[model samples]
Target chain A: MYVAVKGGERAIDNAHAFLAEERRGDPAVPDLSVAQIREQMALAVNRVMTEGSLYDPDLAALAIKQARGDLIEAIFLIRAYRTTLPRLGYSTPVDTGKMATTRRISATYKDLPGGQILGPTFDYTHRLIDFALAAEGDAPPAPQASPLGDVPRVTGFLDREGLIEEEPASDATPGDLTREPMELPADRALRLQALTRGDEGFILSLAYSSQRGFGRTHPFVGELRIGEVAVEMDISELGVAIEIGEITVTECETVNQFTGSKTQPPQFTRGYGLVFGQTERKAISMSLVDRALRWKELGEDDTGAPVQDQEFVLMHADNIQATGFLEHIKLPHYVDFQSELELVRRLRAGMTEAAE
Target chain B: MGLLARAPADRLAALYPHISEHAVLRGPETGAVMVRGRQGGTGAPFNLGEMTLTRCSVRLPCGKDGHAYVQGRNKDHARRAAVLDALLQTEAIGEVTARVLAPLAEAESAQRTARASKAAATKVEFFTMVRGED
Candidate 1:
């Protein structure tokens, strides 16, 4: 007689113990500290923070360490941790226009305000890896002088000429996607929120599809800025807004060509992306997808592209949800498989009798 | 307040040794909290990310309760800040203000000035000259 497989708890405990041992790798090497991950692996920390929707580098680094450098798992840890906290108060919005920019550039103009500050970027670097970096050595610090004054946004110049489509100022509050369940036909604000937290690779592919004639919007990089922005909170007790702290952010704006329609004249439409930390690729991709999703509002024909479908893009963009469902298949499905086997056997027996 | 709470505990302890005699009313526990962002400074609220925060509550012998929430896993900083917070509410406000907060505030401002100067050194001035070609 076959007894049901027991010792699931024991097996799980042993497996976890094995995983913990494997995670440490070698006893000969020193363990990586959270601070090391936070400082040295800054980009990875930034990505986890951007996707996890949290800004604390320390926690993000710890998550990265605990997740064994798996970004999606890090994001999952962050998301799980985020739900337990109390909503202290909402912070006043950050102003990218006033950002102390580290990197700023525009592809549309040869010369523009801010003189195209490249800051720290990997764009011009050759793909070849420097093997010398394999052996641990301290990197010599490059001397840099501070840039004076604020660099005016490139979009401001276009707006001054009335060349681009007018984005009227509105004081209306935007919906919080994290607090409320996402519904169809999401507004620009809600869509942007989704894109900022969306998976970088997924958004990149969607943005690429739009550029490759799937949606076909000739996008010009109007402005892309990465830097620090101050976060302030309105203290009702003090009756004044106080600066809580500063956080690094990446903001992108894309200019897309729009032809004349019956209701509107020919003008350039805009797509915007803003994310936590220094994530230019994600920001650019998000902007492209943001513009694509605005097909209906822009009076453009629906191309039925996956990027244009807000529902599809937003729903599938989260890696945590995707990984959970995909990995769930590894779990036992013995009862369901047995039922299907019995049904097939019964059907085969009935078919043989009917044929006789 | 967050800045004061986030200030290094060892530094605070060294600067003000009087705050060590407070009772831990709540905890110097480590946890995580969600951070939020707004659209363009006054727009709708959106979830930004989770940040690791250390929080604690303390009661001074003078019967004042104080609390603190600081960024990172610095439990000592949280406890020290909470103790200071309680003391500040008592008659030692002037002394604590002079001994504790003044130094922290000065250090914070100096740090900010240094950062500003560093950023200002890279400033570029662009000029568009007329070629007289209409």
Candidate 2:
């Protein structure tokens, strides 16, 4: 009941022209370089990389600049660009154990192996606005110490005591969410992939909801580490797994409340979240949500919570799809709207005639 | 190779100065390599994300082929790294190491020390109280 129409080509072109002009802002001001954004606005770059599922800081910076600092839009640009690049190969699974950690902390332990290194975190900050930053003041040098020798994951302690659930090593080739369409009853691999790239705000809300008793989850931050880990690949030509590069990542592991039936002994459960770039908030939130989704595997009751619903979480978690459908409403839908209006008018007219 | 992947694109050029003519065998092409992570620190593997990687292969006039797989979208970095990779396999390896690899390694270590220093500043120290019997 709708008609097709066209002929906004010139208007569309001019709109883009105006968009470019607006993107530049005042002619008097110096233009911001991609390098500046990459370095200074690093957290923003990390968010785009994590959600866009691409680890290129330069492209993420460029996307941010082009999108005029709209992060979701920047993520869209990165996602589009990734499709253009041909897949070279897959890297060996990164070893977090061998990470050159900058910031590592465990809430459960008072002090453990690798110790608690606060690294760069805003947790202790006063949150007061620093006017000195407005004046471009330089920061004083941070004190140096002898280089750290070795850092181990906090989970190892619980593992040694056999207090926490153990996940045996598996060499199974996990599913790729990007290449394959969303299949129902998606495994942990696919869910983690979706969660890693999911909208940060959405995941945060879900995690918050789970904590608020919508779903029963007593979560504790066992450890959260932000650092760089080498990405390696097995090369047939070289006959060895060569280190390609290091990617900055944030990894979070949560120890949940004990759960066991008559057949099984009580053991602390765990949830994990690993993301590209130093994004601890997203990583922690992802871990909480991940644990919430594991209600089935954990043999917990179906709470009917939004976070527990895999269909809802996985389907709408993608910001690209969510934003596309959402923003599309603002576009010209004259024909569709007109048809609806006409039908309403006809119904009203028929009512009038019947009344008469 | 880790140094090649991590080092800045311009730095590689600065170290090498000049390279003998070489033929491009494969790419100085940018592509993606899927990065994988584990369940806990060590468990079932899953796809974490994709990184922008540039891979290149070059053949020197002396028939030595060098390959480089770097971390970003800089084709020039890949090319220079590839050429150096080939040169390192040749008689000029000692010179290349002194100029490029050694300097890069020193810088990498320095940077690591700096980060470790900052992190070390924040390392928590705990004190336990002991009870004295009366």
What RMSD value applies to candidate 1? 4.1
Compared with the true structure, what per-residue lDDT tens digits does model 1 show for residues A309-354?
Answer: 8889989998888989999877777777888899999999999999
- In model 2 chain A, where is the ten-residue run with the lowest total lDDT? A1-10
The Cα error of candidate 2 at residue A35, in Å, is: 0.8
Please list the residue runs of candidate 1 whose C-alpha ends up more than 4 Å from where it truly belongs after superposition. Answer: A1-6, A352-356, B2-69, B72-75, B78-134
Candidate 1 C-alpha error for residue B49, in Å: 4.1
Q: Could you tell me every candidate's TM-score relative to the true structure?
A: 0.85, 0.97
- How well is each residue in A230-286 modelled by candidate 2, as lDDT tens digits? 999998897988889999999999998866988778888889999999999999999
On the 0 to 100 scale, the lDDT of residue A278 in model 1 is 90
